[model samples]
Target: MRFSLWQPGRLLSKKNVKGWVRLTLGDMGGFRNMKSKWAGKTWGTLGDSITAANGYQPLVQDALGFSRVHNYGVGGCPMTAGGERDYGATTHVGRSIENTLDCVTIFAGVNDFRLDKPLGAIGTLDPCTFYGAYASLIEDILVKNPLCRLNLWTPLHRDKDGYDIHYVNAAGYRLCDYAEAVAALGRIYALPVLDLYAQSGLNKLTLSNFTTDGLHPNEAGHRRIADMAISFLRGL
Candidate 1:
């Protein structure tokens, strides 16, 4: 379904009572073919997944054919590592994605692995640390809906331009390492892991495909992400 931020009142309209689901970085509404009794559920996106150029709403509608979507991706969320010591426990897994659906796709960690900030520097994520959390997320979904499916995607290689002073140091940890970690966890839980980072050389995309900030993707980047996601889903 087509949705716009302009109609906040429509959120409660009977026609849109599925409840809203929010993403940390982008808008919602990609599950056109997938419907939920919890559609329009109140959601609190807590990462940097959404931006002005590529909101999740349109992508969701285009990809999944959902009529409505909610987004809450913050610009600087750390996927593998938690934020400040006090805020570390506030990652997406604990906040919203857990309760949003029977099936969930998690795309994070790049911000946490940022190479610029000394604190955000890349570090090895003990599989033990993330594995449990990842399992818990899947288990939580299954506990609520046993037939649910979880899709976990790993981070892509940093774009060639990503090595600049502003970008993370490419020398730190390889994006593949993180993807492997996610994939490993998926194996443990028997969940489906979509290694789009490996399937698509997103890092090689031209600057025109990226946002002016040189980090996030522009419309082209979002499209690439959507296309890849659709292809992956179709393969299943």
Candidate 2:
């Protein structure tokens, strides 16, 4: 049965209400990760954009060979590992790490650049800024699970929607600039980087098939991500 928001009684009656709640609040109209209820198994996912793109689905978890998955993606969140952003992955990833994760993937920073925040330095004293927030999250992960394989995905290439600018920074910085920053940080931290912006092929001409909006990927797009993830995990 479809999750009907209009039928409040039916929604509340479902066993995994959190899944339904994520589906409803995350604007997940597309039929990608809405199938399974994450009933059994292990593992987890935390981040923004594609990491949390197709709602709470097993696409990435299964690709990387995980048991259960936990999604901590909040719309408009950058890697600000939670502080000023508050609702971001940083606020919850530590608590969510109940056991050693086989793999952890992060896809964030589009929102930080979109919002025109100054990308702070990685080791900056301030933990609330964009760069600092991501730094905090990375540090936290290593402390908790040093052996867990970690991957960082660059934001996908997203065109402007209607009249709204998609991912430009204040000084006219393009999304590629933000993506490059993510890559550089990955190098600094010795994390494998997935260059989705350059490789995902979700440009203006091919966007319709992969993305519902210019920003969020549709089912095809999510599957592409899953395939990329699986390839990466296997190669490692």
Candidate 3:
């Protein structure tokens, strides 16, 4: 039961295969086991600034040992386009959703909240409306990649709409409401939901420690996100 990545004599040779994996992966525990799970698979990420930033992707790649983790995230992109808000050039629906990737991680909603995008009903078919956007996106993904697995990550804590997660945005819906909607949709699709909102240990009070602008995650924050994503995907 030896991994093609590590062996007895090849403890730390940087130029060698084992060393390459070690150098790239660092000292994460259970690396071999976790790495094996995603070793040959490809991944795609979809989201706003947090997902757009030069953060988390490499860490996720190193930790999970995935073959590829492409970023389809656009910074100001919202899940919902809703006719009122002009998205200009970027939208969350990118090549990632249309292609055949082994997995996809969607981490949107913050922009919609910050932009005060309206929250349409749960089954709405309109990609312009929040709920409708998700429904359309999920349906399309299912059709595009029948074997591809997906995970929905709720937006992290931020005061973009309001400092408190319970604070209502201009649209009059709380941040937590959006998070719940994502979780609800995950259930409908029978997919996994990684609730960073409830699990990331980040809040308005501790913004300085984790995020850069109280919205996008910094290096340390990206590591935390990568760790969580790696753990969640491994379990799945």
Candidate number with greatest lDDT: 3
Clashing pairs in 3: 82-128
Give the runs in model 2 whose Cα sits over 4 Å from its true position: 1-42, 55-57, 81-85, 89-96, 162-167
By lDDT, the candidates rank as 3, 2, 1
The digit string of per-residue lDDT tens for model 1 on 1-236 reads: 45533365554444564555434323443343445443443222233443223454365445554334335455544543343532332133444443544345566545444532122212322322344434454555566656544567766555434442234344354545555766776776777777856775555445445444555676766676667766665454
Position 186, candidate 2: lDDT = 91
For residues 1-236, could you state the per-residue lDDT of candidate 3 as single tens digits?
Answer: 23235567665445654435432333444557364678868998888878878599888787677787787777776888655444521234643454689988888887777777777898776777778888777777878787888889998988543445766778998788889899999988899999999999888787778988787788889988988988899888
Please, what are the lDDT tens digits per residue for candidate 2 over residues 92-210? 54446654766667778677666665666766634556666666667778788887777787887776544132545664666776788778879889999988888877788887788
Once superposed on the true structure, which residue ranges of model 1 sit more than 4 Å away at CA?
1-47, 50-57, 85-100, 115-128, 159-172, 205-208
Indicate the TM-score of model 3. Answer: 0.81
Sort by TM-score, best first: what order? 3, 2, 1
Candidate 3 lDDT (Cα, 0 to 1):
0.77
Question: What lDDT score is found at residue 76 in candidate 1?
Answer: 49
lDDT of 2: 0.64
Best TM-score among the predictions, by candidate number: 3
